[model samples]
Target: MARQQFDLIVFDWDGTLMDSTAHITRSIQAACRDLSVPVPTDEAASYVIGLGLRDALAIAAPSLDPHDYPRLAERYRHHFLLTGVETVLFEGVRELLEELRDRGYLLAVATGKSRVGLNRALDEVQLTRFFDGTRCADETFSKPHPAMLQELTRELGQDLGRTLMIGDTTHDLQMAINAGAAGVAVAYGAHPVDALTALAPRFVAENVPALRHWLREYA
Candidate 1:
C-alpha cells in the first residue's frame, strides 16, 4: 500500500514533542498531596495527557468537590512552574521539526494544554520559533473537539485533507478525525502501541526517529 501524504503538520504539545509528563505528574501529585487527596500513579496520569489541567484534575481527583478545583489548579500551576523545571525536546524532535519546516510543511501545535503553559515550555526550550502558532486548551478549546484545528486550518489557509495531526493520545487522534485531517499516533511517549493502534490512526511511530521517517514519506 502507498503511504499517505500531507502538507501541514499539527502537533500535540505535552507528550508528543516534549517530555513533560514528569513535571506534569509531580505538579499534580504535589497539589493532591497538599489537599489530602490521593495522588495518581504514573499510569493514571497518562490518561490525562491531552487534557487541560482543570479537566485532568477533575479526572484524576474525581472524589474532590468541584469547588476545590480552582485552589488545586492554582497550586498545581505554582508547583509546575517552580518544578516543571525539567523539560527537553524528545531526542530528534528538534531535527524533525526543522526538516518538516524546511520541506515547506506548515507546522503548528494544537494542544490540550493552556496557552500560558504551552508558551512557557516553548519559550524555555526556545521552540516557539519553530511553530507558526499554537492553539491551546485555555482558549476554551480542547482536543477531540474540531474547533481548534478548524480554526487553525482557516487561519493558516491550509487544506484540511493535506493537514496531519500527531500526538500520543486518543484525544489527539479524535481531533484529527473530527477535523477531517490525517492522524499519526506516536507510541514512545505516554501511550502503548496497542492502545494507540486501537484508534486506527493513519500512521503510528514508536520514537522520534521513526516518526521523522514516516513524516518524511507522508509529509
Candidate 2:
C-alpha cells in the first residue's frame, strides 16, 4: 500500500518540546542527595529521557537502595516541580507548533512524563492550548510501549498511518514504529543525532526550524 498522508503530529514533551534537561537532572540529583545516593551525570540523565518517572529514577540512580525508590520518586517530583520554573521551551519550538497548527495538522503530545508533570510543564510554559490532546505514561505506558499512541489514535479517531511521531529519543522512534506511524527524530535535543538516525526515522531534523519546514512539506 502507498504511504498514507499524515494528519496528526504527535510530540514528545520533555527534551523535544521543552528544554527541561537541566531541571530534570538537578531534580534527580536532589532526589539522590535526599537519599544519600550518588547523583548521575547529565549524560546519564539524558539516557533516561522518554522513560516514566519511576523508570527514570531507577536509571538515574541505579545504585540507590531499591526500597528507597518510592521515596526517591516522591522527592524527585517535589523538587522537579519546584525548580521547573526555570525550564524553558526549546528555541523555535513554539513557532514550529504554531506553524503546524496553522497548516491544519492536528497536534498532540505523547510523552513518558506523567499527567501531573506534563500538565505542570505545559501550564508553566502556557503551551497546553496548542495541543489537542496529550498522552502521558501515567495515562498509559512509557515510550516504546505504543500504548499512549494507540490510545491517542483511538480517542482522536485518526488512522494510525496518518499520524507522525516526532521526538528526540530512540524510545519515541520505537513507539512510532510500534504504532505503525511515521517517525521523525530531532537532532538538537536529548539523544545524539547519530543514535536517533540509527533508529531509521522517516525524517531526521537537525533543529526545530528544520522540523517545522519538514512539517510544512510533508506532515
Candidate 3:
C-alpha cells in the first residue's frame, strides 16, 4: 500500500458525517416564519449548512435587520429542538472512523455547531472517543475562516502538510485552503459535486464507500 499522506484528519459535522441538512433547513425556515421574515429557499438554507448560526441566518435572510439576529438565532434553536429531528450518522461513517483510527490516523471535528450543540450530538452518538480534538464555531471564527483548522492542527501538534480536511461544503474546502491544508470533498453532503470541484479539492467522493476507498488509497 502507498504510505498515507495525512496523519490528522479533520471532519465537518453537519451534512458531512450526520444527515441533518433537511432538519436544519426546516428549522431555519421555521425561525423565519416565527419572525415574520421571508423563509429562504431550500437551496439557500442548505448553502449555509457549514456556517455559524448567525452568519447563516444573515445570508439566508439578507433583508432582515441585524438587530433581529439574536432573536432569529434563538428561534432557530427553539425550532430545531422542538422538531425532534433524529440524529442519524451517515452510512459507513462508524466503520470509516474505526478503520481510520485502527490505521493510526488522528481524527477531529471542525464544525459550525456551537460547543453545546456539538457536545450533545457527540454524546448521543457515543462518538467522543473517535475524535482526538474538536473546534466549534461558537467558540471560534465560523467556517471558511482558517481559525478552526489552524487551531485543530495546533492542538494536535500536526503540520499543515500532514493534515487533511474532509467536508461536504465549499466553506469547508475554502477553510482548508486558508489553513494551507489539503482537502477532500464529499458530494453526499450540503453542496453539489460541481461546487466542491470548483474549490480544487484533492479528491471528491460521491458517497461514503468512495470516500473510504479514497482515504485508504490516497489519504
Q: Which candidate has the highest lDDT of all? A: 3
TM-score of model 1 (CA atoms): 0.93
User: Taking the tens digit of each residue's C-alpha lDDT, what string does model 2 give over 13-112?
Assistant: 8888988767777778888888888888887877788888888888899888778889999998888767326658889988888877777778999988
Query: Candidate 1 vs candidate 3: which has greater lDDT?
Result: 3
For each candidate, give its TM-score against the true structure.
Answer: 0.93, 0.91, 0.97
- Indicate which candidate wins on TM-score: 3
lDDT of 2 at 99: 73
Per-residue lDDT of 1-219 in model 1, one digit per residue for the tens? 333577678999888999876777777888888899888887786778788778889988888899999999988888887842777789999989888777777899998788877887888889988888689887856778888789888889988888889999888888888989989998877777787889899888888999888877756
Error of model 1, residue 21, in angstroms: 1.5
lDDT of 3 by residue, 31-150 (tens): 999999999989899999999988999998898999999999999999888755677999999999999999889999999999999999999898999999999999999989999989
Error of 3 at 68 (Å): 1.1
Candidate 3 clashing pairs? none
Give candidate 3 misplaced runs (Cα > 4 Å): none
